[model samples]
Target chain A: MGGKVTCTLGEVKNRADFIVYWGGNPAECHPRHFTKYTLMQKSPFLPRGRKDRTMVLVDIRETKSAKASNIFLQVRPGKDFELITLLRAMIKDQPISEAQVAETGLTIEQLQDFVSRMKAAKYGVFFFGMGLSMTRGKHMNSAALLTLAAEMNAFTKFVAMPMRGHGNVTGADVIMRWQTGYPFGISFNRGYPRYNPGEFSTVDVLVRGDTDCAFIIGADPGATMPQPAIDHLAKVPTIVLDPHVTHTSKLARVHITTAPAGISAPGTAYRMDEIPLPLRPALKSPYPSDEEVVRRIKEALLEKPDWMGERPQMLQNQI
Target chain B: MDLKVIDHATCTFCGCVCDDIQLHADDERIHQAKKACVLGKAWFLNHTAERKYPDALIDGKEATVDEAIAAAAEHLYQADMPLVYGMSNTTCEAQRECVEMADHLGGLLDSHTSL
Candidate 1:
């Protein structure tokens, strides 16, 4: 009752009749999302393509993607959780006052119509974005959306997926889950992987100044992270591996130029739907690939004495 | 006007990772990226094979990749709590290496997803 119910983009393209874009603007942030993967593609189930599908966009403000949606619901800023909760209750046929729904800036009638459409659709999908996951209530907002998608399955096929941005972040998540049995925010202090979000998350770790040294690759945290976190990275001995001299590279103690992924580095990258794709490089680069540099760093570390002198190689259970 | 064309080239600017892009490139840079959106085109055309920066830099001074690698390893090895962060733009193979480095260093590992 409380797990993620989702499918690959192909399934979404072929089967989804009701598409709800929550807190995401595909038009600008992800330009090819609508045309390539979701709304425009014609499948046997949805032969008419755009005509056969219903796209509802829910966000705090109107964006270019709204032009493609059949309906645009602008929820009050920071009220996504309230609106989602109200919908959850309404879907269960529970009595809810219009005043409560009004606080979310959407009329009860609109929500009722939305619920009916969700129930009637052959396949429904909720593509939530950073606007939901990184906003007020954070993970709770995402969990609510996922829960709603899971509950909708009682009446029809429904699923939810995060509109993951940045190159190969989903790849990193999938790989971390495979290697450490955790997605992100991992700590290896005990000779085993431990998962903790607030405690081990990069921002929190840097803000807290808990880490002594940092090894960065592919991302420029100096430009993105909070000021305190940025300050801490500058204070520490940071090593950066990137294609360009990025913001983080400027602050780092050491910067190694690595070939850019998907452009000049050949390897595997995962799409937002966790679909693995082969990266074909179009140009040759003077720098080494990230994989080669990281492997070299790992090998350099291995040549030194083991920090972990005597400990169990594996643990049956992690605390 | 002769340019090398790569079909089925994937655009990694965003999560969609559209793999049907056709990239027309020369020895230095990509001249055209067909079937790519505005963002994808910028992503593909912005980077080049040219060595825009030094091969490696230490304390803001130019250095060899080997020296930088050794410096990075020494710094990470000497720390009590080293951190391995940022895998959003790299390949999965490199990500695996980062994770392995964290495990070996008994450090914290995180990604842009955490932000």
Candidate 2:
């Protein structure tokens, strides 16, 4: 994620002249993203601020995010690949068949205008969302977006990044990378690190019935995971560590309540753009902090080093 | 005491971590979260919201943190195959501890943050 993510939220907020909200409804999902970072911002580089910058909203529907755009490109759903490819081709002065142009629902002139605007900007930032990642072409759609950005580089400076959500989700990825040398789905089960995303990922592993028992910390998988995964979590003996009462905890063998990190415990959390910021504790919490509970668990485990050997059948406890 | 404004207060609610928040705190309770979005307001005010607190539980019975942890450790250690999942909302230090624990237990580790 670090290697791929090129620009910071600050950079996007201040420097970008041609901003694109592609397949992402920042108005709804991010709320403050457009207002604080992209459009409507009175940036230093943009002396006239919102007037100095131009935004393009490219989505399948007429989203609220589109209302803020100078030009809204409502490409057909799942036609992102086609639209992006056409933009890239048009940038390179390649001619396309009229039939192919008709399939995209965008006239060649509109695409050429979009490309020319992109080429003319001093600095551009392309912000994409789950619409691009979770769509039909998936990574290919992302590749096309990236390629378009790269092509724009010949005419002007440009960078693209996913409009990541869930706050510290970016933090989780950063910490995981520094710790395991992998972004996600890492296992040290064989006493060595193994990295595999689809195989070792939580839902995949749970759905495959590979995990026998689970210790869930700070998340509610039962409510959010796929049905099979939820069923597995419920059936198997599990532990949930959270401050809030969640669907997963309700079905757990042991529910250890912990204080919310930023609100009740002092810690460092990352912003959406991977900026590490100190999280100040605003209130006193009755529940133990995650750090304390985990330390206690480690202490308990150290005290019972041979416990696993004593009950070797625990490994085979799962069906 | 009168309502006081604490400027440069970071609202940990949303990822923005808007440090510009001026928390109006009366005592330790928040009176209002100024310079915040609705999401940030709800999150900051959530601290004062009434809620139940259960220290720990083991097998549907209330227990001390020690008792529950012991049970949990025992259950985890005995499992031939186990999973250590979800560290999204936790501190990096805590997440490191979890990774170490997972390695020691010879179990797998994953997160809710992983999509």
Candidate 3:
């Protein structure tokens, strides 16, 4: 799920006979997942469109998204590992103990039927999210699902993806990986790149009163971050470059409003599946682009004594 | 009002970034959004909202774009330990620029990466 989505969503729409949603609700998080592309839309290959594909929703409890599923398995929370592990064994035709099926709240026959359907399907896509990432045995749960997908690949085309929470979080992480060779929470303060979460993460830095001022480019931590970070942001001198008038904007010491990236200023964004798509602006914006604003800030910083007066700070700091 | 369809416009409102949105608009402003969900529609329709200032604001008062940039730059110059953040919604190109600025100023840069 990190970077290997072997099949595109378009392929999933046309070729995938079966789709599984585990621990995430696309109906709630990704509204267009069912409507625009996958289940609801009709294709030459899928003449039945929504009807042509089988949808399975596996969640801890009943969710609105379950309303769209052909099968909704209400798995007991914290037992995802046991359930998926058993499913893996079922794929290999290995017998599963009834006790395990009871823990999963599903009968052995139901599990057998699911395995048979997956084996018969032309293709399958298993999408999971926070439910798997945030649960006990976190990465292990996801790995179990991935192992299932890989094992299923032997019988039918199968792929897995994480329904990311933020729009460009995957993009951000991708960009960070390209630039710093690390995904997130990287610090270059020591004249070299350092990767640590609580120490280098934004809110943690603010909560520790480590930041004297803030140079916020496109995000609003005030609306989302913990109260302590927001309070720190409100009191500190801050520069904001955003499209809307966000919670952080109201308290911004320097609020430089810009056009929204995709709506007003066109750019590139990676989808949840790590598919890069071009964002075409529909209207002309009155304000500058985020890139332009950041470039100007970079230019402005270049003129500062802290910058112009010395070498790149990393080197200057080392001396 | 003349209404026209802008096809294949990607929604900037969310992470989904649905690119199939068709913003129906006129010579002056946007009117209706076809293929956009409720959140995307709300985002596209906001193109018509009236604001006292169209370009920028400095400490809540309207300011020219140059003034805002200068004010922000001046603030960065004064702070001994500035923190650069919130690039989750911006483009990769813009994010790199923010990183450049953060590194140049010897500031503490942070974002959704922490959370």
Candidate 4:
């Protein structure tokens, strides 16, 4: 199995001579990615900044980010997995025909050239976005890309990192890993943390009607989740905490307006590269912070009966 | 009117979480967001200190924060399987509270990463 091999944004700024944006349009989504960290930053290693670096963009369509790249490869929609697999095989000196390459909307010459560039670069990095991870193949596509990045290490220094979406998500992942020993998709019904993605994931649980109630904070899933999941949230008694009146708040049984994080709420938020930064709030809102509301909810729950029966505080062994 | 300048204010609109933004704000609203991108500018300019919406709402009707909290707890406690979800737009402190809430309720805990 291929595990994640990545470095901090500072490493990318200093050492990455070759950078690839796969399926992500960082120019618009993460505006400072190029100017502050990747292509435009002048470092000790990359003295010329954007002049010394090479950028490659691979996406189904031509986004604004393509303009910033030296080479833009327009891939066929839903063919990310196939393209990644071909790259992996090519990197290993395996055989692949032109017909197979054409199926992914890229010619054999383009892939061959891409492979040569991959092997020739001193330091390379891939920044994949939701366009790759949330596509038809989903995790399979992500895994393939990670595998390709790992394989490239044979010839040069290479790494891959996901361009995580919106506000302190990386913090949640990092914190959850520390507290529950799992990143996400966790259940504590058996008195300990249990991890399972498809089963315990919020969308799956809501779509299946397995959850009778939902406590939503920060995210507006009513506008983002699938119709069935949204319907289930409406069916159940849902509670929402957000600074503004969002789509989720409209359908929620209870909506508590809270101060927006990093704006009016003081706390920590992790960058996509897993760097923790302290939030310096500039304004004060009349509403409570999400932290206070969640803490109050927890205290309210504690006032009631104990849900865990005879289970010990610490689990001797995880089943 | 004098505006307060805050340097190194972080923008959490996206994953990059650019922390070098300089914000100029009064007590009511942010006047200018220097070194911020278009998205970051919109993010800072949109939210204000002035009261815009109700503090709490139960079934679309205005309610007290205490009443809303009690109602929320009652609903979650009464359910057989409750879900604590969506930590994407909040702080780490709130996220920790969410995890604790799930553990205490014996419920499902998830974040935007699972989606």
Q: lDDT per model, in order?
A: 0.92, 0.77, 0.77, 0.91
Could you list the CA RMSD of all candidates, in the order they appear? 2.3, 4.7, 4.2, 2.3
Model 4: runs farther than 4 Å from truth? A1-3, A313-319
**Model 4 interface RMSD, one decimal:** 1.6
Candidate 2 Cα outliers beyond 4 Å, as residue runs: A306-319, B1-4, B49-51
Per-prediction TM-score, please? 0.97, 0.90, 0.83, 0.97
True contacts kept of 2: 0.54
Docking class of 3: medium
Q: Interface Cα RMSD for all candidates?
A: 1.6, 3.8, 2.6, 1.6
Cα lDDT tens digits for candidate 1, A99-216: 8998999998899999999999999999999999999999999999999999888889999999989889999998888888899999999998999999999999999999999999
Give lDDT tens digits, candidate 3, residues A35-73.
765688777888888888999999999999999999988
Predicted structure 3: lDDT: 0.77
lDDT of 4 by residue, A1-319 (tens): 0148889999999999999999999989998899988899998898989999999999999999999999999999999999999999999999998888999999888899999999999999999999999998999999899888888998999999999889899999988887888999999898889999999999999888999999999999999999999999999999999998899999999999999898899999999989999998999989999999999988999899876667644332221
Q: What does DockQ come to for candidate 4? A: 0.77
Better of 3 and 4 by TM-score: 4
Cα DockQ of the candidate 3 complex: 0.56
